[model samples]
Target: MTRALLLVDIQLDYFPGGAFPLAEPEAAAVAARTVLDSFRESGELVVHIFHVATAPDATFFVPETPGIGFHPAVAPLDGETTLEKHQPNSFIDTGLETVLREAGVTELVIVGMMSSMCIDSTTRAAHELGFVCTVVSDACAAPDLTLGETTVPGASVHAAFMAALDGSFATVTPSASLV
Candidate 1:
């Protein structure tokens, strides 16, 4: 089966000094770069997914802003496939499925930011679409989350989401093991 590498929302907005920086996003990007390089070396399919918020009330990832640009560490190289999306699920109106199907990609190696959001959503969607997904856990970041009176640290949020996704949705792994 053909496999592809999917880098989701590793954009400027998630890094330090950006709109909504996540916890240790740089580390995640570095690890993702490792996997990206591996895919490039193998001449495998690599798709870079960017989230561009077009809503009038959107706060981050606004259109035509540097915040929406892909981070340098995992930026798509020349000739690599790049797709933009308006929602957390990368497949929604993004032509990602069509692209994958055309490329005969049956498996996905996913790495990105916000483990609790886009990463979770995309992995679930990919799994349901019958693609074998392998998430690079260390190559995905998560922001601090708070609801009601409780606030969860990003590390805890990341670990919890990774735990939830393992086996059920995707095979959660690390960059080192992958490459």
Candidate 2:
């Protein structure tokens, strides 16, 4: 099966010191970089989904902001393609579907930020659009924990999001076991 890794919103804005930082997003970012590098070594496809806030009165992810660009360490190579998105779902206002269709991508290995939002949205959308999705458990995150200090970690949020999508939307797996 033709597989493509759908890297969603690994931008600087979501990093720990950025404008809208996620909780421990750096961990997922590192894992995603490793996954992308592996895909490059194995001659696989890596599609980057970059979220650009196009709203006139934007609060977060504004393109002009320093945070809008991708994190320094997770740069895309020449062969990799970038899809700019205005909405949470990468396929929402972008050519993600078209690009995937053109590449004949049957199965998607998904990873990136905001596990409960954009990540979850696109995973389900891919399934509805007939592409099998495998969400990288350790390569996604959510900003808010369950409650307080005893709340769940962002990684757990990642796993829960994956589990919630089971059977109906997609399957979930760890980045190390993906290949």
In lDDT terms, how accurate is model 2?
A: 0.83
Cα lDDT, model 2, residue 66: 85
Error of 1 at 125 (Å): 0.5
Candidate achieving the largest lDDT: 1
**What does candidate 1's lDDT look like per residue over 61-82, in tens digits?**
9999999999999878889999
Clashes of each: 0, 0
Maximum-TM-score candidate: 1
Per-residue accuracy of model 2 over 121-159 as CA lDDT, tens digit each? 999889989999888877787875766557776667767
TM-score of each: 0.98, 0.90
Clashing pairs in 1: none
Relative to the true structure, candidate 2 reaches a TM of 0.90
lDDT of 1: 0.96
